[model samples]
Target: MIKLLSLLALLWVYMAVVGATHTADLSRKSFPKGFLFGTATSAYQVEGMASKGGRGPSIWDEFIKTPGAYFSFFKHLLEDINLMVNLNFDAYRFSISWSRIFPNGTGKVNRKGVAYYNRLINYMLRKGITPYANLNHYDLPLALENKYLGWLSHDVVKDYADYAEFCFKTFGDRVKNWMTFNEPRVVAALGYDNGFFAPGRCSKAYGNCTAGNSATEPYIVTHNLILSHAAAVQRYRQKYQEKQKGRIGILLDFVWYEPLTRSKADNYAAQRARDFHVGWFLHPLVYGEYPKTMQNIVKDRLPKFTKEEVKMVKGSFDLIGINQYTTYYMYDPHTSPPKDLGYQADWNVGFAYERKGVPIGPRTKLYEEDILCVQAYSNWLYNVPWGLHKAIMYIKERYGNPTVILAENGMDDPGNLTMSKALHDTTRINYYKGYLAALKQSVDEGANVVGYFAWSLLDNFEWRIGYTSRFGIVYVDFKTLKRTPKMSAYWFKKILRKNK
Candidate 1:
């Protein structure tokens, strides 16, 4: 039975590759000159030498130790670089695993780990693909977590700065673009408030975890994360950036929250949601403090920065990477406040999928009999292209129109589909067409978006989702660790082709 199944899968894959089509609705010519098109992946997601190369375990490694609960890209650097070059991608944004460099999170440098990244970056440069290196991507070294409970304690700020400094001194020359942390908000909320990610912790009422105070921990973690970012930026500016001529930034995830209705209450609810989401990070970076809504609602629970700290935290980035994917409708929940308190509960708003029996957008397949909005493989991801425009504009109007990168913008399909169906990927192609158009519209209106990177280069591990969600233009055959360009890959090639 196993042999037969393998043979059938190979046959389908061959059919899928041969049947693939190359088509695109938009072109690179639609955007400003020097605007880059690239793909993104994280160290752990793509570099699958989890325990190899003298690397230590990350919190994620320990968190997902259950049998059959892991997957990765198997670290094919040269081949992956060649793939991106062939797709006409101009850049690659990838994370550096913290544990890979300092096995114990600090002190000794792992030579093997350093050599591997040097090779990867060098190869990318040789292939004319710019390297955008992100210092951390949620894979905190387990040693730090065990020692000082990771981001929860203030002690981590200096240690994290040290780690960032090491990376700056080492990789700052060839790698010109640097992002401190990817989605620190997600790190705070999902890892602390909901217990859904590694080093999972939450209030008993919020999620299943052995230890945490969801209401307070998320704020504390966020506060430290922000300080850590600021310290790293400070170090780079003082020590490395001027010499290397590089830029540093942080990656933030934003979900545009539209008012469920035009009523003042709904509008206020939407604003509150926005303040609590992207504003949670950007407000501090751009304005030197948390959003007023968060400060007022969370009150004493939200940590305050010292006067000196504010100076360092403010204006810490050369650019901002917005990892936008979806949007939601928010309205004033007229009911009384909840007895069980947490980061989400503190918002004092309610989420609604539809109003007056009509969804915010068209449905992909009429998801349920009643829910009309189109959705991706992930339940939370909805197909709403306008959200991208709104998200970029929100930063423009509110956050001083600082330079932005559409760091991650792509939808996923279920990973279980047969090879033929997966490679066809008409829906993924449409998703990109709609989104790229929306992004182009924003750029035309002066959003200062210099580049765009699709969510991934291959179907790799998706943290909590494991291997169940496919968010790659290049399909990977997990059975054989094979790489095949999906129709969307050819679509990108055609649109991004410079020779035309």
Candidate 2:
């Protein structure tokens, strides 16, 4: 805990110093000509007035309202929505909350919800900025969670198709780019296995060891989510292709996994980790099936698809959205596997966490000397920009050079500083510089990377973390609802202008 605190303190100081002295040579450092630069946000995170939009309660609404929840009674969504639209966002990527549109998750269209997003979308277009929209971002209607198996149920595939069709029909004419889902793995893991985020339910001990639902839920949800994505893609291709001429795909969050040692055991462990993480989604879309290693490891825990289903899922996407953050080191150690055959065993096959070496340079303070460091806000996010480049390269090699759009990537600072105050965020600027350089390298090496969208446009509700961690390029003053563009925002604008 002290180490974490020290890391945060160093980050704050580093940002303060860098923000003061940071200035890029716009002539020397610029993005490729025509590369798109933008910022992203999610619906549940920024759109408040959940009840006003003919929006029925989502699991998030219920989760936040729980007695001891972090965002309970916190109305920061409207503030964020207003700040995002009224601020200096060139291209804004956000999601349409499911329950907000179809109040009960199925049946009727929520006119108020439709009006709210229509207003937001039109507002962005009026500002001369294109709106990149996603259909779902980890928030399911409470009604759906109650009636169906959530993503765990196969029925969700059709229901999700219906929802996607509705959105494409309603907004596709204006919104050119559409994402089917955002980081489904995180949703499945948090909702089912860990029970840390929402719909918290941890499986009880059956015989001797405690089991986690997350282990199996992902396989189940992936099966459904992929089919749902395929169905949506099918609808788009058949119904709206000639009319809208829009592109649709899924946003996959990937992390580069490296073996700790050159030994065969460690190498094999690293391979297993990669297949389990990236291949979980990529395989179904690319190869029409889940990773073979996942099936070999988890055995029956993974869901099987019929031949027809595989055909439906395989080769269905028009593009792939990569959302990478950090890298993880994998090591193999001699140990017994877990007793149960559910989720915990997914990574328990003598696999252990290994830390990677941090680069030593003038920015060493931000770079923890050890492999595994702490994040300012989320425990899972460690500061590692190099991983982003490696992830893009891996996608290129594995998926046959698919046109990739970096959907979400950014740094999170602990300080509750607004954009006006975050001007001194040198650490963040450096972080972006390093990652952007890596991405540029990937493009030069033939990665077919087209655009980059920073993780967020403004600081908003960070799900379970509430609004504690800020990843916005433009800072939001929660109290006054003021939006201020940070130095990074200025730097991004310069990069975008240079590219243009």
Best by TM-score: 1
Model 2 stretches astray by more than 4 angstroms: 1-29, 66-90, 205-215, 349-377, 415-423, 498-500
What lDDT would each prediction earn against the true structure? 0.87, 0.71
Q: How well is each residue in 94-186 modelled by candidate 1, as lDDT tens digits? A: 999999999999999999999988999999999999999999999999999999999998999999999999998998889899999999999
**Prediction 1 TM-score vs. true:** 0.92
Residue 495 CA displacement from its true place in model 2, Å = 2.6
Deviation of model 2 at 228, angstroms: 1.1
> Candidate 2 residues 1-500, lDDT tens each?
99999877776656544443343553223556656667787877766666664778887777678422222112444444454444444567788989988988899888877887787777667666778899999888888888975777888888889999999988988999899999887776666666665666445532221334555665676678788889898989899977998888889888777777788988888788788777888888998878888878778877788988877888988888888766667777657665654454566534323344442112222445432112334545555556777789888998898988888887776545434345555456666766777787788889988888888777667887776778877776666656677776666655554323
The TM-score of candidate 2 is 0.85
Give each model a TM-score: 0.92, 0.85
- Which pairs clash in the backbone of model 1? none
The lDDT, on a scale of 0 to 1, for candidate 1 is: 0.87
